[model samples]
Target: MRYHACRIAVSLSLALPLAGCATGVKSQLEVRPWHSINEFRDQRFADVADPWEGFNLGMYRFNYYLDKYLLIPVVNGYEFVTPTFVQHRVSGIFNNLGEVRNLTNSLLQLKGGESATTLGRFLTNTIIGLGGMFDPATRFGLDRHDQDFGKTLGYWGAGSGPYLVLPFFGPSSVRDTGGLAVDTGITYGIYTALDPFADTGHSFAISAGVASLEAVDMRHQQSFRYYESGYPFEYYMVRFLYHEKREIETGKAPTAN
Candidate 1:
């Protein structure tokens, strides 16, 4: 009886771990069967730590459809309505506004020189560039410095919790997503406060429209299309590249592996 019991225990130990695997993240660790269903859904038990792969896949499909039917059409309409010069000016204005977030993040990362430069860019563009409709700062020596709260968090040693496929935003990790929220809120507040509209509601409405236009412009800046990678492991590849980018931004050198 003792010999049979030992054999059975060994079998269960090996088999149990293999019973619950991630849908696509290919985690080496298996979900513990003893845990509740909710635990498995949220717990990180694998290499990629994407416990919500099924939900992510569904969101990805939804985003793709939204992009195909809605976002792209709206962006194209924006392009058609505006002349190239106006579009460039709009892009510049958005870039100029983004400097506030960059400045704050630069200070957080302790890059005093970059923070100074970001402030310079903002002031110069707002004045000479005609409220950021042009980029006179770049014509001189001060180039645009792009920083974000996400990079700040990574610089401080916060691990990217898990890979996520955000609707319309594409690949992002938990840390970066939170960073995006903070940055957006900061910018929205700044714009609303500075908006010429006396009414808070009108200022908010204007800022929200500008923010939507900025999002469309930003999306159009990237040319990559879904499933165009020509490989079966496209999702895995995006997750790897994104993490690598975050690592570089945070001054972490990626291993040769």
Candidate 2:
């Protein structure tokens, strides 16, 4: 659970800078391609009633409270102990998870026995070799990578269905939502060997803690840019960059505006 929290914190740190850059670069780049994608999604978005959107917004508000109170403090406590190591380990865990996701998606997309073999090796190393404490794929020259079902669908020439802000989950494309389900299943299988109740509580605590830490890290990084943009823009900009970063992880070029 601590490991998971660390991963989330690290992801947010990396995400903040990338997101900041995306925002700055937004005006300089032509985003027509992505806009087209967005427009297509907007049609689907409209099919859902505004009340549902409002409900999602309300849930987001609740998440903010969780972020501020429980999650943030736990991350701060971890930071006070060993800032650098904690940060690195957190980032490494996050990257490692991404690599696993990528490997899975890549196999699903590419469909090769060799890919499955490599994925098995990765799972073995991350689970047993690392004491489940770290992911060594990057160090082993496997190259940290990730792919989601959405990217797989895109590779197969399916359009991104829609843009949706899921409550608590954040920004996601229609395809990615399905990808998340598969990923969660994989995660569940991996974690199921442990005691169920204890593992569940620990995982939840760690996730909350990591998110809080990430919010703190983002607050620090965004402080300098706060004067340049309002909170809403900053928020959306962060979401856009995180989503795009995931796309990049799946081996796609940054989406054009």
Candidate 3:
């Protein structure tokens, strides 16, 4: 029973980062020539390296339903009750906390400049911005530079092994999934260390509540809706785009033919 409870907790944490990096695609269905679903799927995925296509597709559909039925409704309720200023402040706090992950990964990659910038941003936001309720770092020209353990691995020549649509987490590669675990561990450690309620018996409950709020804020910041792209082969497009975007960001973009 404990094991199952732990599994549920883990799943909820992993699934909260939905659509954070996804881009919406405008449809060409009205103007494009007709083609059967099979033909379109086959043609678009012909050269893709998704060996887990069947599993990935199933998970993709599962995520769509999960977002539609569970996540979005909660997000709607959060927006309904919270004022806009409060929403932005919540988002800012989370983003400021994210700088910890970014700073760690940048240092791992030996990116001296990026590490310094990230550190500066964290200090500036936390101190001057009042617990990250505002972003003063950007105004000072210390732009937010996001980094992750996955990108650090890629920088050191680790390949993105397979295309995967993680349950609740959405699109990821094998490398990024592992990176996510490492980054999550880092964030969890910070939460534990800085927990103001640690001396109180309610630390666990407070932590859970904060985590839930962070998840909702993440979804609130995202605007992409599944299947709203209006492309018949959206799964294919998203898969391809995800791979390409990661490659470019990690400086491993494929050479032009």
Candidate 4:
């Protein structure tokens, strides 16, 4: 009787953790067992359609650690050392530079009004605002129409593919990823064509330095941090919210059913 009881006790202990981990599925098991692995996964993550949950979860943890240990400290130091006015100027410069992307995308989307407004803002800010250190164009009533290639693709009815958690860029879809590459290529080509630093003979160094500053400024402007919501289901929530937000902004329905 003692040996039989020990075996029962061991079996119960082993089953308990698996049962706890199964959560909602265990209750459904009473009705019927899962039909397939896909069915089991679908039920397990019914709240979010995360087919790549394993990889996405890994990237999420990686981003959290990277932000906490490296990016946050660097951004903090930048903010601490730089004056507010200087920071504003830096942001303005980057915003001015981004107008190229905005203008190109606006043209692609056939947004005549937005393209004109973006062009006016770019010219006004670059020439008058001294390379976008100031935003006199906003005061002059030429509002910025921030557009990107991703939105352009969406505008043309391109479906957002699977959810992706990029190494540096974080949450993005397959369509957006491709759009980003195209936009980046366009910008790089334009920069190469203009070659503003050609005369200095240190174009590469100058470009690298500017790129680094732009990266830091970008990080400084963003206020989001990983796990900041204090929710256990933050990953699923973020994934869902990102998809919904993109759908609304792009006016394109998700095609990844």
Candidate 5:
């Protein structure tokens, strides 16, 4: 039981981040073409490295149903039960906690300034923002910088390779998948370190609670809905945008508007 609980907790913690990073994506691509939503998804996109288009589109369809039936419903319930102010505080805490990750990746990229900024934001929020239950750092002119192992890989010239739609994780690339594993492992290590425990079941529960809070808060922050964008080439558009966004993120390209 102890071992199982430990495994479950770590897995959940890792899986929960999928929600936060997967959604709330804005299209960085000027969408073109008008493929049927039910168009044959067998062949991969010609330009990108998505060799598994059939599998990816199937997963995309699955994620749409999952979001509509399960994820959105749960987020709706969370919004109904929690006050807006409380929700805001929860989001702040999650963002502040993410500064730790940003800091680590920034250092790996040799971005001394970004690393310093992340540390400053973390300190300000934790101290003045009441353990990041508020975001006083932003008001103090220290906004958070998004960083990850994926961006770290890109910094060192790692190509994205191919697109993939991971089950329950939505869109990612081959390089980004590797980044996710390293990032998740580090995050799990931190959670265990901060919340040391004897009872593995209890530890799992604690991890679940934190992960759940982050997931719900992330969902509430998103304005996008699955399949709501009335674009016929939505799948291809998202694929394009994701890759474009990655390039912009790694400073290899400029932001699209």
Candidate 6:
């Protein structure tokens, strides 16, 4: 039970940043006095203890395993399989999924029959469109967008309530956290792998793969910053930057700096 809870926490933590930003941006745009959520989040920040040491330890352990097992063996295997490509195709695939998500959100906000039809089409395409391997919504000239019940509630004029950093889930506004449960429930076909354990296995693999890729990229892009501020700050910065970027993409107001 503890292990399951930890996994759930970690999964929610990673997912919240990706999905939360879009919803949060939508909420900011549709609502007023946006500081309500920010204020709540800020208050929680006071209670937030830095966990850089623990995160660093975990990263170190995970990276060692990745280097010794996954990267050394599988990455090399991929090179032999696709010698022309220097980077893994997984990144491209994930990017394509992002494009699909953006397109879906844009269409949803428009609320037009044509857009609705396209949403269905794109969903189909992503699920069965690119051999179920890639999503091409962005490539088709549609702008990316995102929405969630939290954003929907804000659009309907609900308050953002408070900000909270869940033990494993990191940063979230109280309203947004509530919406996460709804989003998870409504999102279907996301875990429909063939094997009973396939979803679990896939989730773990993707998490580890993304972490490894991030570590390598961060080593090159922000090694100095990582060394200077330590891991917790680095993690928060990453989340902040990610949310800010999503706001920019969706044409929504960002949290005040």
Model 3's lDDT to the true fold? 0.81
Query: What's model 6's lDDT at 243?
Result: 37
Clashing pairs in 1: none
Please list the C-alpha lDDT of all candidates, in the order they appear. 0.73, 0.54, 0.81, 0.79, 0.77, 0.45
Give a tens-digit lDDT track for model 6, residues 105-155: 444456575456456545654665452244454456544344555555455
In candidate 1, where is summed lDDT lowest over 10 consecutive residues? 1-10
Rank candidates, TM-score, best first: 3, 5, 4, 1, 2, 6
Tens-digit lDDT track for model 2 on 1-257? Answer: 01123434565565457547776877999654343223444432133222344554555566566556765555556567757855666554555555566677778788575466557556855776463246554456544344566777767766555555564455566667776787877866765565345646587777667556555544332222221333323434444444444445445534459
Off by over 4 Å in 5: 1-46, 196-201, 254-257
Candidate 1 lDDT over residue span 210-251, tens digit each? 668888887666666665544434454455556555666676
**How would you encode candidate 5's per-residue C-alpha lDDT over 109-211 as one tens digit per residue?**
9999888888999999999999899888888888688889998999999988789988667779999999989998998889767775546658777777878
- Pick by lDDT: which candidate is best? 3
Residue-by-residue lDDT tens digits, candidate 4, 1-257: 01123433453355345535666565666645333334444532244446687898799899899889988898899999999999999999998999999999999999999999999999999999999999999999998876788889999988888888887678887888899999999999999999999999999999999998998888788877887654345566567566766666676534656
Looking at model 4, the pairs that clash are: none
Q: Which model scores highest in TM-score?
A: 3
Q: Each candidate: how many clashes?
A: 0, 4, 0, 0, 0, 3
**What's each prediction's TM-score?**
0.75, 0.51, 0.83, 0.78, 0.79, 0.39
Q: On a 0 to 100 scale, what is the lDDT of residue 17 in model 3?
A: 34
Candidate 5 clashes between residue pairs 3 or more apart in a chain or in different chains: none
Question: On a 0 to 100 scale, what is the lDDT of residue 162 in model 6?
Answer: 44
RMSD from true fold, candidate 6:
14.6
Model 5 scores worst on lDDT over the 10 consecutive residues at 1-10
The alpha-carbon deviation from the true structure for residue 202 of candidate 5, after best TM-score superposition, in angstroms, is 2.7
Q: Model 2 — which ten-residue stretch has the worst lDDT?
A: 219-228
- How do the residues 1-257 of candidate 3 rate in per-residue lDDT, one tens digit apiece? 01123433453244333332222322522444554546655553344578898899899999899999999999999999999999999999999989999999999999999999999999999999998999999999999987899998899999999888898788899999999999999888876778889888999898889889988888889877888755556677667666766777788876769
Candidate 2's displacement at residue 91, Å, is 5.8
The list of candidate 2 runs beyond 4 A from truth reads 1-60, 82-99, 111-129, 132-140, 193-232, 235-257
Say which prediction, candidate 1 or candidate 3, comes out ahead on TM-score. Answer: 3
